[model samples]
Target: MPAPGSAALGVDEPRSASAIVGATVTGHHLLHIDGYSRTKHKLPTGQFIKSLPFSVGGRSWCISYYPNGLRSEYADFVSVFLHLDKSAGEPVKARTKFCLLDRAGKPVPSNTSTTEPYEYLPGGVGFGIAQFISTAFLEKSEYLLDDCFKITCDIIMSEELRTEDRIAASPFVAVPPSDLNRHLGDLLAAQDGADVTFQVAGETFRAHRFLLAARSPVFKAELWGTMKESAATMVSLRIDDMLPQVFKALLHFIYTDSLPEMEGQEEAVMAQRLLEAAVRYGMPRLKLICEDRLCRHLDVRTAATTLVLAEQHNCHGLKEACIEFLKSPRLLEAVVETDGFEHLTKSFPALVKELMCKLAAH
Candidate 1:
């Protein structure tokens, strides 16, 4: 049928349909069954009831049930499934919960009473119970209403998206650098214009009165109150008990919230001394660090001393760690022969009793 100068016709454009945008909407979808028992004897292998399709939060979903079970392994139990029919982009995650309805049209009590979350991958991915409940249990169970059982799936949708900025996101910037520690360190380093000094053994350490007062309430009372250290312009506070190195480490901890590593026997010994000094100055964080270090270095040789120190300062963590290390009869027997053991037994007898109680319980 050839025609000269003739043009073919085309259909007109249809009206535009509205599309969703912005943040992914969220909602819960429910799929209910009326006579669940009616499908109880469908097929022994597996069967899907008329696929009840549901659309929620811009995704397609389907609910199905298998009477004799989904797999041979689950043949003794009834199985239910939640399937992702269609998804716009990447896999979407949703939670599904199945229920057995009573005659009152409410959920019946059954072992299948929990929410199951699943990732619906692109193409299709599904999740469900392979062994929900035995058929014998459900058949006689009061869950059936006129031999009708119902199931409800609560579909929870979420906006799981990756924006351009999220692809290479910056780490959280929580705490900005501040002058509190650095400036305090400056006061410790520059000792120029310092107003206070501490004498340990024969060494004199330069310090600031306000710095000590700000750090420790004990120092505040001694440096500014009726104490003799308050009166002098360049105050000299005498501490006869502590060594020069231990006292220096305490000042470092006050300026910088850190401590030296527990390297060897000497540093471990130094840590014990520093912990007591920290306790005297009301530095709980320093004491906690010391406890952690001491716990790591615990041995038959040091366990007795660390336990005594823990008891004296009420450092419960260090005390418990000491007791735990002594759980070995060999270690405990060796610890009893150490010189520190004799000292601890003589000084802190109550701690000995407490250790005995914990070991007995163990």
Candidate 2:
């Protein structure tokens, strides 16, 4: 058995500290083994040495070998190196490099004769490193020492295991209610003088108010009913019941027709507000956004309230989502124990009673 760091037959030691030695030929290629030696030895007739050279901790070494005389010429030559770093307080690194050599002991330059570096971390974990030299560089004899160094740095960083401390914390920090209200005031103030025009169902309407008053089904039925009777005609119906601040936001969306950028906890609130406005104004798209946000952001407590609101306004989708949320066994118990459930049950007695019975069966 070949010892670690020893070269196989017909392989030579690397010429430099950083260079990796690999196979001179690939697959089954017969070649004559003229001679082989490790520490400065001469080769026989057809035999030559191939090696990969690398240095770690201020020490350099190579791995080389000789081929069998009777081996078929189809056998290619390969050199393997085992690198060990013993620097104090430093990581241990190991890698392999390959090269192709001709019968006359010369490197056979080609796309296939490239070197790839692999790494072993401190804890015996292993991974592949990036390619040191590009194929173009090899073909043109353009040395990419600088590129290799850059790649080495990248590999070191890549191999460094990530701890929780290094990872970025969530940007969704909690915001004080005062700050939230202040931000809402600023949003509303920004749209104080804006006018927006939108079509609900089929009728077009214009409003200077920042809030989507048409979102209220009651208001939509009263005002837009005369324009078109078909449900499809309610295309541009605006929502009106959105909170004053939320209405301002909806108005902003109607005019700009773009999402409002927000950060942290504000994102959920803004999304919820926008969804409510969308649902109220008969904006199917915005309603969908709200549904997604409610599903993702609202906790069981808030979801129960949203359920009541949804049912009150005949928002079937929202109601269904709420029902699904409340169906969770753990959450159902929590909901039953809350004052909010009592209010919801009293408000939608039939629906809540039925839901409670269904939950009991589960």
Candidate 3:
């Protein structure tokens, strides 16, 4: 009654390849320990207070807080752990993070610990940091307010399900990554919708006023505020003391939120100049990027110069990196012989004194 290649004969039916659906489930729990001092004095090492059971990734979980350490060897530290309250049919893969909360209940970055994904067997001592924080530090820090403190446990579990749902061997269409930056970069290249013009070192550059104002506070005031330049329909602003190339790069960043590729030696020069421009324009992220670039480029030849830039720009991380690089007596002696060190000593005598003091102590 049923023909071949027909539904009734089952030949026309599509075959489904098995597909495994997987996702990560994330959950966080906050445990507040009141009378922290009493707990530390009363609860001996290896004793813990258990949190109420919570659910994540379709499984029950809880946190174990040890005021004193979990073991006598770690008695000077506080410990935290994540425990799987429910038994699993197979080993579960998960990531765990523990964070000490500040007085405002926000997680302190310096006191957070994150773990890589680990396979957890049921009934085993769950994965966590044994020495989350030293007891001495806890007592001295502002985190322990009114003899109380809080901690947050974040858990991410990888869960998989085997299903019979049919899917194509390959997708019918592949979505591409975002091209917003590319489009904006093209817009900059095309000079379309540009309303502002800048004359820097006898060079002309065109840019959009709204984009510049949106990106930088200094640009906002210069273009949109009560400055005389803001009243013009097509404003022509003259920039003094900046190189045409640096100004061009700054416009590119305003449009694309990224820097163009440059040669190795040119990149360092560009980074230093861009850092100055970033500071002048109140672009904190770009300033940080330049500071990081300069830090990586530090050497005996460039250490003192980088330190001077860092000091003038108030880039603490870069300054510290430069100081660390110049700490060795051999390196210091070599750097002190450079002309950059002469400029640094003349410009930032206080910084030079600080470095000398640190070197003496070392």
Please tell me which predicted candidate would have the highest TM-score against the true structure. Answer: 3
Model 1 pairs whose backbones collide: 36-149
Q: TM-score for candidate 2, please give it.
A: 0.34
Lowest-lDDT window of 10 residues in candidate 1? 1-10
Best lDDT among the predictions, by candidate number: 3
- Please write out the lDDT profile of model 2 over residues 293-352, one tens digit for every residue: 455455656767777766665667667767777778888788777777878777778877
List the RMSD of every prediction in angstroms. Answer: 23.9, 26.2, 20.2
By lDDT rank, best first, the candidates go 3, 1, 2
TM-score pick, better of 2 and 3: 3
Once fitted onto the true fold, the runs of candidate 3 whose alpha carbons sit more than 4 angstroms away are: 1-173, 226-232
Off by over 4 Å in 2: 1-244, 263-276, 360-362
**C-alpha lDDT (0 to 100) for residue 177 of candidate 1:** 16
Per-residue alpha-carbon lDDT of candidate 3 for residues 195-276, written as tens digits (9 for 90 to 100): 8889999999988888888899999988875335455467789999899999999988888777766645687899999999
